[model samples]
Target: MDLHGPLRDASDTILASRAIDGDLVAFEVIAHRHGPLMRVLAANLLGSELESDDVVQEAFISAWRHLGELNDPARIRSWLMRIVSNRALDRIRARRHHDDIDAADRASTGPSTEALVEHRMQLDAVWIALGRLPADQRRCWLLRETAGYSYAEIGETLDIPVSTVRGLLARARATLLLEMEAWR
Candidate 1:
C-alpha cells in the first residue's frame, strides 16, 4: 500500500491506528499533517528557531511511542499537542535553570558595565513579569498572540476546554495590560 495515497482518505484515527500497527508511512502522514502547527507551538514556547526544531522532534518521537495509549483516536491532535507542550515545558525549565546558573556565575565574577547591566535589568524585569503569569495563561497568550493560533485551534492544541482557554487568555491579557500601564 502506498501510504501517502491512503493517508489522504484516512481520518486521523485511521492513520493513528495504522501507525500503531507499525506502519511508518502512516505515521509520516500524521507527522506531516501536524508538523507545521507543532513547529509554531515549539518556537513560541522555546523562543528560538533551533530549539523549537529539537522540541518538535522529541515530541514526535514521544507520540510514536505512546500511540497505543491514546484513548480517543479522533483526539489525536490534542494528544500530540499535549506531548509537545510537555516537551516544550521541559526545554523551557532547563533553559531557565541554565540561565540562572549563568547569572549566578556572572554575579560572582562582577557585573558588566553599568549601561549593559541596566539594559539587562530592564530585560529581566519584562521576563519576570511574564514569568509571574500562570503556566496556562502564559501558554495561551504565547500560542494565540505570538504563534497566531486561533481560539479553537489553540483550545485543540493545548487540550484545554475552550472556555478555559478563553478565561486563561483573558487573564493573560489583563496581566499584560496592567504591566504595560505600570511601565507607562
Candidate 2:
C-alpha cells in the first residue's frame, strides 16, 4: 500500500490552506504528492508520457493560480485530476486537428508478429465498440474506469448528476457487452 497519495491526512488540507495563503513550499509539497498520478492519467488519455508531463505541469500551474477558489482542500487530488483531464482532452483535440489523414505509417517498433496481430485486433475491436458510445457516456466510462473516480467525483468533474453518471455507465456497459459478444 502506498502510504503517500491522500491517506486521510490533515496534511493535504493544511498544505492546501497554506498554499492558498501564498506559501510556495506548501504548494510544492502538494505538487510532489499528486503529480505522478496526474501524469499517468494524462498519459493514458493522450498516449504519450512526455506530453503527459507537459499537461500535468500546466495543470499544476493552473491549480496554483486558482488555489484560492478550491472549495474542499481534501478533495484536491480529484480537482487536480480534473484539470489534467481537461488539459489532456484539449491536447487530443489539437492533435486531431493537426493530423494528416493521408500520411502513411512512419515507423514501427519490433514486436513478434503473432503478438502484434492479436493485440492490434483486440484494440481495434475495443476502440470500435467505444466509438459507438455517445460522447457523454464515453467520457463517463473513461473517467470512472481509467481515473478510478467515484460517481460523485465524476459528476463533479463533468458537472453532471450521480444518477446521470450511473445511467450513462449502465448504457455504455450494455452497448459494450453486445459489441464484445463475438469475442467472448
Candidate 3:
C-alpha cells in the first residue's frame, strides 16, 4: 500500500502502529509528515534555528524509542509536542549552564574593554530583573510569550491549573511593565 494511504486513513495511529511493527518506510513517512511542525515548534521554543534542529532530532529519536508507550495513538501530535518540549527544556538548561561558565570566565579575566564591560553590565541588569520574578511567573511568561504557547496549553505543559496560569501570566506582565517603565 502507498504511504499516504495509511496516513490519510483516519489518524496517525495507523502509521504509528506500522512503524512500531518495524516498518521503516512507515516510520519515515510518519517522521516526514510531522517533521515540519516539530521543527516550527522547536524553533519557537529554542529561539535558534540550529538549536531547533538538534532538539527536533532528539525528540524524534525519543519518540521512536517510546512509541509503544503511547496509549492513545490518535494523540500523536500532543505526544510529539511533549517530546519536543522536554528536549527543548533540556537544551535550555544546558545552554544556561554554558552561559554561566562563560560569564564566570569573563569575570575572572576582568573587563578587557569598556564596550565589553558595558555589555556585561546591561546583561547583568536584565538578569537581575528577570531573577526578581517569581519562578512560576517567569516560566509562564517564557512559555507563553517566548515559546508562543496558549494559556490552556501552558497549563497542560506545566501541569498547573488554567486559572493559575492566567494569574501568573498577569503578574508576570505587570512586573515586566513596571521594569520597562523603570528602564525608561
Q: What is the lDDT of candidate 3?
A: 0.75
Ten-residue segment with the worst summed lDDT in candidate 1? 96-105
Which model is ahead, 2 or 3, in terms of lDDT?
2
Predictions ranked by lDDT, top down? 1, 2, 3
Give lDDT per model, in order.
0.79, 0.78, 0.75
Question: On a 0 to 100 scale, what is the lDDT of residue 25 in model 1?
Answer: 88
lDDT of 1 by residue, 31-119 (tens): 88888888888887777888888889999999988888988878888788778877987786666434443454467566555645565
Top-TM-score structure, candidate number: 1
- TM-score of every model versus the real structure: 0.66, 0.60, 0.59
Alpha-carbon deviation at 131 in model 2, angstroms: 14
Model 1 residue runs over 4 Å out of place are 1-3, 100-148, 159-161, 168-184
Local error of candidate 2 at residue 155 (angstroms): 9.9
lDDT for 128 (candidate 2) = 78
Write the number of the candidate with greater lDDT, choosing between 1 and 2: 1
Q: After superposition, how far is residue 58 of candidate 1 from its true place, in Å?
A: 0.6
Q: Which residue ranges in model 2 land beyond 4 Å of their true spot? A: 1-10, 105-139, 144-168, 171-184
